[model samples]
Target: MRTAEQVTFGGSGLNRAAQIRGDAAALAQAMADPAARCLPMWRGKPLLRGDGLDALGLIPMDHPVLAAGLGKAIRAPVFLGLEEDGAPRFAHDLSRWEPEELDYGALGSFVDRSEQRHPDLPEDMAFAELRRVMTALSPRDAELAATAKAIIGWHATHRFCARCGVETVIGHAGWQRDCPDCGGHHFPRTDPVVIMLITHGDAVLMGRSPGWPEGMYSLLAGFVEPGETLEAAVRREVMEEAGVPVGAVSYLASQPWPFPASLMFGCAGEALAREITIDPVEIEDAIWVSRADMMTAFAGEHPTIKPARRGAIAHFLLQNWLADTLN
Candidate 1:
């Protein structure tokens, strides 16, 4: 399990400057430093370079691309963390100024599928989806992108205070929202989810959601309910989704899945029974694949089922399981 951090979006050791977030003067000092860098995002796509999906583009604070994207608007920057050299880094959401006439390609119903354009940036500076290329990114880059996306997405959805229904303003270096009326302070939230790798002797249980591409399967996952432990969540999810009883659940690894801010807790579960009674609502299909069949799937030689995403925790765990490297 020590290889846990090696999973995509897991092991970035960014020194999150938590102590200075509330210090306005310290924040200003960091921002004014020459080494200060800012990452830009349009819609939800982050600006990245290079030919592969793993590339992330973090420009200097004085970059012209940002000025062209947002004009002179002084939006609050999210202070992600500091680099190993102590240079401060921040992220700005430049999704406010997208041209109305560009094609964004195909998209999901709830996604911001439109890619933005800027007069100052080259064509290769386009923002792209994080899920498609998270594995290709350096760990720090992935963490920064995930942090920015999650905080920005939170600000977008939670503009008002739940306590008194008052509009809240960003504060605490974009980590908190303050309600002027009720003295309420709100911080960003990271929801907990448990994704299970269930084993039954030689086979592993995998499930397919209703809308996933045909033959695509992955570890069964579900959000943790109030007051549920990680072990309990794994057991509950496996039983609820696949009607398979589980025992002795153990943690393996974790990942920051910022498809709008989630911490995926990867766990191994010993299934008490192999028979699966699929929950029609939770998943469309449930099947157990023998270790040999999974090897074929991973090698792209399987006739039907495709492998889990290469960098995702599911695939990481599966690969290790096959290699007997789950320590």
Candidate 2:
């Protein structure tokens, strides 16, 4: 689809510097260069230094504040990429800095709001949630943040080898984990999820989970089961959650959802029936709302239903559908 890359976290044609990742000598030189800059993530939240909503922030790699932290890395700093000017970029996960933890439910709630200030950095910087500010960020920044989050999150969880149950060491400039015992190498994993825009005439299928904020309904989604195609996953998820059979599934767009790493495949499917037999365990409620009502919800005018948050694939897909602009 034409709008595929317009989604938050879509690629921005950055040079990932893959060739240098495995070259120890080159990586060491780049790390020592004055052009090296890093984005520090604390408890999964990245530090920020922008005043405007759309600004991009960078922390100098040699800055005193980050120097001490880098020396004490939980692991090697993950190399992000080089900018157009060849400035090296890396992301450092500093969950150990001040001993704060990331609670998934409260991720967007400011990580360093009341923390002690460092003399080297500006005082007004905000470490805001990536999701809450994704729409406001440029596509490039969004992609950078998402990439950093996914790789760092992966390193956080995959500290040991699955095959040998042995400790693994970071390698390939943070892109790989090597296990000495098993002679195994592991890369970051991205879970595949299918989010369906199931439609019956003018209405679209949406559901709410038990713990989501009230009135926050979104496209019916589920992880793609092993050996399942995207279309099959979409069809299966809709049926399992809402008991609505789906047919003629087609791809729409995709988004990289990095709340601990997921690659969301947005799909459209034809709903064969409208009657919902709620699977109480999977979803709290299922409803088919006409395009008109969906518009109202999108505008935040619906009495009880709220639209999917902006910047999410659900919002993007629904907005395009409403305008008949899906390509």
Which of the numbered candidates is closest to the native, going by highest lDDT? Answer: 1
After superposing candidate 1 on the true structure, give the runs of residues whose Cα lies further than 4 Å from its correct spot: 64-74, 103-105, 109-115
lDDT of 2 by residue, 111-191 (tens): 223332334557755455677678887777888888988888888888899998898888999999899998999999999
**Model 2 whole-model lDDT (C-alpha atoms):** 0.81
Please list all clashing residue pairs in model 2, or write none if there are none.
none
In model 1, residue pairs whose N, Cα or C atoms come closer than 3 Å (at least 3 residues apart or on different chains), thus clashing, are 1-327, 54-136
lDDT of each: 0.83, 0.81
Best by TM-score: 1
How much lDDT does candidate 1 score?
0.83
Residue-wise C-alpha lDDT for candidate 1, range 91-163, written one tens digit per residue: 8878777576766554453234345546676666667777766777888898888888888888877889999
Decoy 1 TM-score against native: 0.94
